[model samples]
Target: MATTTDKVLNRKIVEKARKMKSYAYASDDPEISDFSHPSVINIADTVQVGISTGGSSPAMARKIKIKTESFLKKNISSEDIYQIKLQKFARIEAKQVLSTQLDRKKFLYGVMNDKRVKGLLKEGKYKMAQGRVKKMLRKLT
Candidate 1:
Protein backbone atom coordinates (compact mmCIF):
# COMPACT_ATOMS: atom_id res chain seq x y z
CA MET A 1 0.00 0.00 0.00
CA ALA A 2 1.22 3.51 -0.81
CA THR A 3 0.18 6.82 0.81
CA THR A 4 0.40 10.15 -1.05
CA THR A 5 1.80 13.32 0.67
CA ASP A 6 0.30 16.73 -0.09
CA LYS A 7 2.58 19.78 -0.48
CA VAL A 8 0.23 22.05 1.55
CA LEU A 9 0.44 19.73 4.62
CA ASN A 10 3.89 21.20 5.54
CA ARG A 11 2.50 24.77 6.06
CA LYS A 12 3.23 26.55 9.42
CA ILE A 13 -0.23 28.25 9.39
CA VAL A 14 -1.94 24.85 9.40
CA GLU A 15 0.21 23.69 12.37
CA LYS A 16 -0.62 26.88 14.37
CA ALA A 17 -4.34 26.46 13.72
CA ARG A 18 -4.19 22.86 14.99
CA LYS A 19 -2.52 24.04 18.26
CA MET A 20 -4.97 26.96 18.90
CA LYS A 21 -7.32 26.81 21.87
CA SER A 22 -11.05 26.10 21.48
CA TYR A 23 -13.88 27.15 23.84
CA ALA A 24 -17.55 26.24 24.14
CA TYR A 25 -20.43 26.84 26.57
CA ALA A 26 -23.97 25.49 26.73
CA SER A 27 -27.12 25.98 28.83
CA ASP A 28 -29.26 23.00 29.83
CA ASP A 29 -32.66 24.64 29.32
CA PRO A 30 -33.54 26.41 26.12
CA GLU A 31 -36.10 28.67 27.88
CA ILE A 32 -33.45 30.04 30.23
CA SER A 33 -30.60 32.16 28.89
CA ASP A 34 -26.98 31.97 29.96
CA PHE A 35 -24.42 34.78 30.07
CA SER A 36 -20.70 34.35 29.50
CA HIS A 37 -18.37 34.58 32.53
CA PRO A 38 -17.58 38.04 31.22
CA SER A 39 -21.20 39.21 31.08
CA VAL A 40 -22.48 41.54 28.36
CA ILE A 41 -25.17 44.20 28.00
CA ASN A 42 -26.96 44.65 24.68
CA ILE A 43 -28.46 48.12 24.12
CA ALA A 44 -30.79 49.35 21.37
CA ASP A 45 -29.64 46.38 19.25
CA THR A 46 -26.64 48.58 18.30
CA VAL A 47 -24.48 49.04 21.41
CA GLN A 48 -22.97 46.32 23.61
CA VAL A 49 -21.09 46.21 26.90
CA GLY A 50 -18.73 43.52 28.14
CA ILE A 51 -17.53 42.96 31.72
CA SER A 52 -14.41 40.91 32.40
CA THR A 53 -12.84 39.85 35.68
CA GLY A 54 -9.36 39.47 34.12
CA GLY A 55 -9.14 35.81 35.23
CA SER A 56 -10.69 36.63 38.60
CA SER A 57 -14.29 36.03 39.81
CA PRO A 58 -17.09 35.41 37.31
CA ALA A 59 -19.66 36.31 39.96
CA MET A 60 -18.15 39.78 40.39
CA ALA A 61 -18.28 40.34 36.63
CA ARG A 62 -21.92 39.29 36.49
CA LYS A 63 -22.86 41.61 39.36
CA ILE A 64 -21.11 44.57 37.78
CA LYS A 65 -22.74 43.86 34.42
CA ILE A 66 -26.24 43.80 35.94
CA LYS A 67 -25.80 47.13 37.70
CA THR A 68 -24.21 48.80 34.67
CA GLU A 69 -26.83 47.50 32.26
CA SER A 70 -29.67 48.60 34.50
CA PHE A 71 -28.23 52.08 34.86
CA LEU A 72 -27.65 52.48 31.11
CA LYS A 73 -31.09 51.12 30.22
CA LYS A 74 -32.65 53.60 32.62
CA ASN A 75 -30.71 56.60 31.28
CA ILE A 76 -30.57 55.90 27.53
CA SER A 77 -33.85 55.99 25.64
CA SER A 78 -35.19 55.86 22.08
CA GLU A 79 -35.60 59.65 22.21
CA ASP A 80 -31.82 60.03 22.58
CA ILE A 81 -31.32 57.92 19.47
CA TYR A 82 -33.99 59.90 17.61
CA GLN A 83 -32.19 63.16 18.45
CA ILE A 84 -28.93 61.65 17.14
CA LYS A 85 -30.60 60.53 13.92
CA LEU A 86 -32.04 64.01 13.42
CA GLN A 87 -28.55 65.51 13.85
CA LYS A 88 -27.11 63.05 11.33
CA PHE A 89 -29.59 64.18 8.69
CA ALA A 90 -28.95 67.81 9.59
CA ARG A 91 -25.23 67.18 9.05
CA ILE A 92 -25.87 66.02 5.47
CA GLU A 93 -27.85 69.18 4.77
CA ALA A 94 -25.22 71.32 6.51
CA LYS A 95 -22.50 69.94 4.19
CA GLN A 96 -23.86 71.91 1.21
CA VAL A 97 -23.77 75.19 3.14
CA LEU A 98 -20.63 74.60 5.24
CA SER A 99 -18.36 73.73 2.22
CA THR A 100 -15.93 71.55 4.23
CA GLN A 101 -16.13 68.58 6.63
CA LEU A 102 -14.22 70.52 9.28
CA ASP A 103 -16.65 73.45 9.07
CA ARG A 104 -19.65 71.09 9.32
CA LYS A 105 -18.14 69.35 12.35
CA LYS A 106 -17.45 72.70 14.06
CA PHE A 107 -21.02 73.85 13.45
CA LEU A 108 -22.36 70.57 14.84
CA TYR A 109 -20.12 70.81 17.90
CA GLY A 110 -21.53 74.26 18.68
CA VAL A 111 -25.10 73.07 18.20
CA MET A 112 -24.53 70.15 20.56
CA ASN A 113 -23.13 72.46 23.22
CA ASP A 114 -26.08 74.88 23.07
CA LYS A 115 -27.76 75.07 26.51
CA ARG A 116 -31.37 74.94 25.27
CA VAL A 117 -30.71 71.93 23.05
CA LYS A 118 -28.97 70.15 25.91
CA GLY A 119 -31.95 70.72 28.23
CA LEU A 120 -34.48 69.43 25.68
CA LEU A 121 -32.41 66.29 25.03
CA LYS A 122 -31.99 65.65 28.76
CA GLU A 123 -35.76 65.89 29.15
CA GLY A 124 -36.27 63.28 26.40
CA LYS A 125 -38.03 65.75 24.11
CA TYR A 126 -36.63 64.65 20.77
CA LYS A 127 -39.23 66.62 18.80
CA MET A 128 -38.13 69.84 20.48
CA ALA A 129 -34.50 68.93 19.83
CA GLN A 130 -35.25 68.38 16.13
CA GLY A 131 -36.96 71.78 15.96
CA ARG A 132 -33.96 73.37 17.64
CA VAL A 133 -31.60 71.75 15.13
CA LYS A 134 -33.82 72.98 12.27
CA LYS A 135 -33.71 76.52 13.63
CA MET A 136 -29.95 76.32 13.95
CA LEU A 137 -29.61 74.93 10.41
CA ARG A 138 -31.77 77.76 9.10
CA LYS A 139 -29.31 80.24 10.58
CA LEU A 140 -26.44 78.62 8.64
CA THR A 141 -28.40 78.85 5.38
Candidate 2:
Protein backbone atom coordinates (compact mmCIF):
# COMPACT_ATOMS: atom_id res chain seq x y z
CA MET A 1 0.00 0.00 0.00
CA ALA A 2 1.36 3.40 -1.01
CA THR A 3 1.49 6.25 1.50
CA THR A 4 -0.32 9.50 0.65
CA THR A 5 3.01 11.27 0.02
CA ASP A 6 4.19 8.46 -2.28
CA LYS A 7 0.98 8.58 -4.29
CA VAL A 8 1.17 12.37 -4.66
CA LEU A 9 4.79 12.18 -5.83
CA ASN A 10 3.98 9.48 -8.40
CA ARG A 11 1.08 11.51 -9.76
CA LYS A 12 3.32 14.60 -10.04
CA ILE A 13 6.04 12.64 -11.87
CA VAL A 14 3.52 11.14 -14.36
CA GLU A 15 1.88 14.51 -15.03
CA LYS A 16 5.24 16.17 -15.66
CA ALA A 17 6.29 13.39 -18.05
CA ARG A 18 3.03 13.72 -19.99
CA LYS A 19 3.46 17.49 -20.32
CA MET A 20 7.03 17.12 -21.59
CA LYS A 21 6.03 14.48 -24.17
CA SER A 22 3.19 16.65 -25.53
CA TYR A 23 5.38 19.32 -27.19
CA ALA A 24 7.48 19.14 -30.36
CA TYR A 25 11.24 19.57 -29.90
CA ALA A 26 11.51 22.57 -32.22
CA SER A 27 8.15 24.14 -31.57
CA ASP A 28 7.73 27.85 -32.34
CA ASP A 29 4.44 28.05 -30.47
CA PRO A 30 5.14 30.28 -27.45
CA GLU A 31 2.25 28.93 -25.39
CA ILE A 32 3.61 25.42 -24.92
CA SER A 33 4.51 24.17 -21.45
CA ASP A 34 7.65 22.22 -20.54
CA PHE A 35 7.99 20.26 -17.30
CA SER A 36 9.74 17.02 -16.38
CA HIS A 37 10.48 15.24 -13.12
CA PRO A 38 13.23 12.71 -12.67
CA SER A 39 12.27 9.55 -10.80
CA VAL A 40 14.42 7.71 -8.27
CA ILE A 41 15.00 4.93 -10.80
CA ASN A 42 16.17 7.46 -13.38
CA ILE A 43 18.58 9.00 -10.86
CA ALA A 44 19.97 5.55 -9.92
CA ASP A 45 20.45 4.67 -13.59
CA THR A 46 22.34 7.91 -14.27
CA VAL A 47 24.55 7.40 -11.19
CA GLN A 48 25.33 3.82 -12.24
CA VAL A 49 26.23 4.96 -15.74
CA GLY A 50 28.45 7.72 -14.34
CA ILE A 51 30.23 5.27 -12.04
CA SER A 52 30.85 2.92 -14.94
CA THR A 53 32.16 5.83 -17.06
CA GLY A 54 34.51 6.96 -14.23
CA GLY A 55 35.31 10.60 -13.39
CA SER A 56 32.84 13.54 -13.57
CA SER A 57 32.74 15.81 -16.60
CA PRO A 58 33.40 19.61 -16.71
CA ALA A 59 31.73 20.24 -20.10
CA MET A 60 28.80 22.13 -18.58
CA ALA A 61 31.12 24.20 -16.35
CA ARG A 62 33.33 25.11 -19.33
CA LYS A 63 30.29 26.07 -21.44
CA ILE A 64 29.00 28.35 -18.66
CA LYS A 65 32.44 30.03 -18.29
CA ILE A 66 32.68 30.66 -22.04
CA LYS A 67 29.12 32.09 -22.13
CA THR A 68 29.85 34.42 -19.20
CA GLU A 69 33.08 35.68 -20.79
CA SER A 70 31.31 36.28 -24.13
CA PHE A 71 28.49 38.17 -22.42
CA LEU A 72 30.93 40.42 -20.55
CA LYS A 73 32.83 41.14 -23.79
CA LYS A 74 29.63 42.08 -25.73
CA ASN A 75 27.77 43.96 -23.01
CA ILE A 76 25.27 46.55 -24.27
CA SER A 77 26.15 50.22 -23.96
CA SER A 78 24.18 52.52 -21.63
CA GLU A 79 22.48 54.19 -24.63
CA ASP A 80 21.35 50.88 -26.11
CA ILE A 81 20.09 49.67 -22.75
CA TYR A 82 18.12 52.90 -22.32
CA GLN A 83 16.66 52.50 -25.80
CA ILE A 84 15.49 48.96 -25.10
CA LYS A 85 13.80 49.99 -21.84
CA LEU A 86 12.06 52.91 -23.53
CA GLN A 87 10.77 50.74 -26.36
CA LYS A 88 9.27 48.32 -23.83
CA PHE A 89 7.51 51.05 -21.82
CA ALA A 90 6.37 52.79 -25.00
CA ARG A 91 4.73 49.57 -26.14
CA ILE A 92 2.82 49.40 -22.84
CA GLU A 93 1.63 53.02 -23.16
CA ALA A 94 0.63 52.51 -26.81
CA LYS A 95 -1.58 49.63 -25.73
CA GLN A 96 -3.25 51.81 -23.12
CA VAL A 97 -4.25 54.40 -25.79
CA LEU A 98 -7.09 52.16 -27.01
CA SER A 99 -8.79 52.26 -23.59
CA THR A 100 -8.35 55.88 -22.62
CA GLN A 101 -9.08 59.28 -24.16
CA LEU A 102 -5.86 60.84 -22.96
CA ASP A 103 -4.78 63.82 -25.13
CA ARG A 104 -2.72 62.18 -27.89
CA LYS A 105 -0.72 65.24 -28.82
CA LYS A 106 0.02 66.17 -25.26
CA PHE A 107 0.72 62.57 -24.46
CA LEU A 108 3.07 62.25 -27.45
CA TYR A 109 4.71 65.54 -26.72
CA GLY A 110 5.04 64.29 -23.20
CA VAL A 111 6.64 61.09 -24.44
CA MET A 112 8.88 62.98 -26.89
CA ASN A 113 10.06 65.20 -24.10
CA ASP A 114 10.80 62.10 -21.99
CA LYS A 115 14.51 61.38 -22.09
CA ARG A 116 13.99 57.67 -22.51
CA VAL A 117 11.48 57.90 -25.39
CA LYS A 118 13.58 60.55 -27.12
CA GLY A 119 16.55 58.21 -26.98
CA LEU A 120 14.41 55.46 -28.52
CA LEU A 121 13.41 57.75 -31.43
CA LYS A 122 17.05 58.69 -32.01
CA GLU A 123 17.83 54.96 -32.21
CA GLY A 124 15.31 54.70 -35.15
CA LYS A 125 12.67 52.50 -33.51
CA TYR A 126 9.73 53.77 -35.59
CA LYS A 127 7.16 51.81 -33.56
CA MET A 128 6.91 54.92 -31.40
CA ALA A 129 5.22 56.64 -34.33
CA GLN A 130 1.97 55.07 -33.19
CA GLY A 131 2.29 56.90 -29.89
CA ARG A 132 2.47 60.17 -31.79
CA VAL A 133 -0.79 59.45 -33.63
CA LYS A 134 -2.39 58.45 -30.36
CA LYS A 135 -1.36 61.85 -29.01
CA MET A 136 -3.56 63.47 -31.68
CA LEU A 137 -6.57 61.50 -30.41
CA ARG A 138 -5.82 62.78 -26.93
CA LYS A 139 -6.17 66.33 -28.28
CA LEU A 140 -9.62 65.64 -29.82
CA THR A 141 -10.95 64.00 -26.66
Candidate 3:
Protein backbone atom coordinates (compact mmCIF):
# COMPACT_ATOMS: atom_id res chain seq x y z
CA MET A 1 0.00 0.00 0.00
CA ALA A 2 1.38 3.39 -0.94
CA THR A 3 1.36 6.04 1.77
CA THR A 4 0.13 9.59 1.27
CA THR A 5 3.73 10.84 0.91
CA ASP A 6 4.50 8.23 -1.71
CA LYS A 7 1.45 9.25 -3.72
CA VAL A 8 2.42 12.91 -3.52
CA LEU A 9 5.98 12.15 -4.62
CA ASN A 10 4.79 10.10 -7.53
CA ARG A 11 2.47 12.89 -8.64
CA LYS A 12 5.31 15.41 -8.46
CA ILE A 13 7.61 13.20 -10.50
CA VAL A 14 4.96 12.69 -13.12
CA GLU A 15 4.32 16.40 -13.33
CA LYS A 16 8.02 17.15 -13.70
CA ALA A 17 8.53 14.58 -16.39
CA ARG A 18 5.49 15.86 -18.24
CA LYS A 19 6.68 19.46 -18.06
CA MET A 20 10.01 18.33 -19.43
CA LYS A 21 8.35 16.69 -22.40
CA SER A 22 8.97 13.18 -21.15
CA TYR A 23 6.93 10.31 -19.80
CA ALA A 24 7.30 8.84 -16.34
CA TYR A 25 6.22 5.62 -14.77
CA ALA A 26 6.45 5.00 -11.07
CA SER A 27 8.52 1.99 -10.19
CA ASP A 28 10.09 0.97 -6.90
CA ASP A 29 11.71 -1.82 -8.83
CA PRO A 30 15.45 -1.14 -8.83
CA GLU A 31 16.55 -2.82 -12.03
CA ILE A 32 14.05 -0.94 -14.19
CA SER A 33 15.57 2.47 -13.50
CA ASP A 34 19.08 1.93 -12.19
CA PHE A 35 20.70 3.30 -15.31
CA SER A 36 18.46 6.37 -15.35
CA HIS A 37 20.46 7.96 -12.58
CA PRO A 38 22.73 10.84 -13.58
CA SER A 39 25.81 9.13 -12.16
CA VAL A 40 25.36 6.42 -14.75
CA ILE A 41 26.90 8.74 -17.32
CA ASN A 42 30.07 8.91 -15.27
CA ILE A 43 30.12 5.14 -14.98
CA ALA A 44 29.59 4.82 -18.73
CA ASP A 45 32.61 7.00 -19.46
CA THR A 46 34.75 4.06 -18.32
CA VAL A 47 32.52 1.07 -19.01
CA GLN A 48 28.94 -0.11 -18.91
CA VAL A 49 27.67 -3.23 -17.21
CA GLY A 50 24.07 -3.85 -16.21
CA ILE A 51 23.11 -5.07 -12.77
CA SER A 52 19.66 -6.52 -12.22
CA THR A 53 17.93 -7.18 -8.94
CA GLY A 54 14.72 -8.27 -10.69
CA GLY A 55 12.87 -5.40 -8.95
CA SER A 56 13.46 -6.81 -5.50
CA SER A 57 16.28 -4.68 -4.07
CA PRO A 58 17.79 -1.41 -5.22
CA ALA A 59 20.44 -1.21 -2.49
CA MET A 60 22.11 -4.43 -3.52
CA ALA A 61 21.99 -3.41 -7.15
CA ARG A 62 23.60 -0.06 -6.37
CA LYS A 63 26.40 -1.76 -4.43
CA ILE A 64 27.07 -4.27 -7.17
CA LYS A 65 27.04 -1.56 -9.83
CA ILE A 66 29.56 0.49 -7.87
CA LYS A 67 31.95 -2.43 -7.46
CA THR A 68 31.60 -3.47 -11.10
CA GLU A 69 32.16 0.07 -12.36
CA SER A 70 35.25 0.44 -10.18
CA PHE A 71 36.69 -2.82 -11.48
CA LEU A 72 35.99 -1.88 -15.10
CA LYS A 73 37.45 1.61 -14.75
CA LYS A 74 40.65 0.17 -13.30
CA ASN A 75 40.98 -2.51 -15.97
CA ILE A 76 39.61 -0.81 -19.10
CA SER A 77 41.70 1.74 -20.95
CA SER A 78 40.99 4.31 -23.65
CA GLU A 79 43.16 2.29 -26.00
CA ASP A 80 40.84 -0.68 -25.56
CA ILE A 81 37.89 1.48 -26.59
CA TYR A 82 39.88 2.78 -29.55
CA GLN A 83 40.72 -0.75 -30.62
CA ILE A 84 37.05 -1.67 -30.50
CA LYS A 85 36.15 1.27 -32.74
CA LEU A 86 38.98 0.38 -35.14
CA GLN A 87 37.76 -3.19 -35.39
CA LYS A 88 34.22 -1.97 -36.10
CA PHE A 89 35.48 0.15 -38.98
CA ALA A 90 37.58 -2.70 -40.29
CA ARG A 91 34.56 -5.01 -40.23
CA ILE A 92 32.45 -2.48 -42.14
CA GLU A 93 35.08 -2.14 -44.84
CA ALA A 94 35.60 -5.87 -44.96
CA LYS A 95 31.88 -6.29 -45.67
CA GLN A 96 32.40 -4.35 -48.89
CA VAL A 97 35.65 -6.06 -49.90
CA LEU A 98 34.71 -9.64 -49.12
CA SER A 99 31.68 -10.71 -51.14
CA THR A 100 30.57 -13.71 -49.11
CA GLN A 101 29.79 -13.74 -45.39
CA LEU A 102 32.12 -16.69 -44.92
CA ASP A 103 34.95 -14.87 -46.63
CA ARG A 104 34.42 -11.80 -44.49
CA LYS A 105 34.34 -13.79 -41.26
CA LYS A 106 37.37 -15.84 -42.27
CA PHE A 107 39.39 -12.77 -43.18
CA LEU A 108 38.52 -10.97 -39.94
CA TYR A 109 39.12 -14.16 -37.92
CA GLY A 110 42.56 -14.57 -39.39
CA VAL A 111 43.44 -10.92 -38.84
CA MET A 112 42.29 -10.96 -35.21
CA ASN A 113 43.71 -14.40 -34.43
CA ASP A 114 47.12 -13.80 -35.96
CA LYS A 115 49.95 -14.62 -33.53
CA ARG A 116 51.63 -11.26 -34.12
CA VAL A 117 48.42 -9.36 -33.52
CA LYS A 118 47.70 -11.39 -30.40
CA GLY A 119 51.22 -10.84 -29.09
CA LEU A 120 51.11 -7.13 -29.80
CA LEU A 121 47.72 -6.82 -28.09
CA LYS A 122 48.97 -8.74 -25.05
CA GLU A 123 51.88 -6.30 -24.85
CA GLY A 124 49.47 -3.30 -24.87
CA LYS A 125 50.55 -2.39 -28.39
CA TYR A 126 47.15 -1.65 -29.88
CA LYS A 127 48.53 0.86 -32.36
CA MET A 128 50.59 -1.88 -34.04
CA ALA A 129 47.50 -4.03 -34.59
CA GLN A 130 45.56 -0.96 -35.71
CA GLY A 131 48.16 -0.27 -38.34
CA ARG A 132 48.18 -3.86 -39.52
CA VAL A 133 44.36 -4.05 -39.76
CA LYS A 134 44.16 -0.80 -41.69
CA LYS A 135 46.97 -1.87 -44.02
CA MET A 136 45.27 -5.21 -44.69
CA LEU A 137 41.98 -3.44 -45.36
CA ARG A 138 43.72 -1.04 -47.72
CA LYS A 139 45.18 -3.94 -49.64
CA LEU A 140 41.74 -5.49 -49.94
CA THR A 141 40.26 -2.27 -51.30
The prediction achieving the highest TM-score against the true structure is: 3
Give candidate 3 misplaced runs (Cα > 4 Å): 1-24, 29-47, 115-131, 138-141
Choose 1 or 3, whichever is better by TM-score.
3
In the range 17-110, model 3's lDDT, one tens digit per residue, is: 7677675554552332322322241443444566756656667777877877778787776556645555676688788778888877777877
lDDT tens digits by residue: candidate 1, 61-94: 8889988998999987765665566678668778
What are the TM-scores, per candidate, against the unseen true structure? Answer: 0.49, 0.29, 0.57
For model 2, how does the per-residue alpha-carbon lDDT over 1-141 read when each residue is reduced to its tens digit?
111345455445545656666432111211222422111111212211111111122344345445554454365444444444544555466556544535443454465466645655667754664455445446645
Q: Which parts of model 2 have CA positions greater than 4 angstroms off?
A: 1-58, 61-65, 68-75, 98-141
Query: In order, what lDDT does every prediction score?
Result: 0.65, 0.43, 0.63
- What order do you get sorting by lDDT, best first? 1, 3, 2
The clash count of every prediction, one per candidate, is: 0, 6, 0
**Candidate 1: residue 53 Cα off by (Å):** 6.3
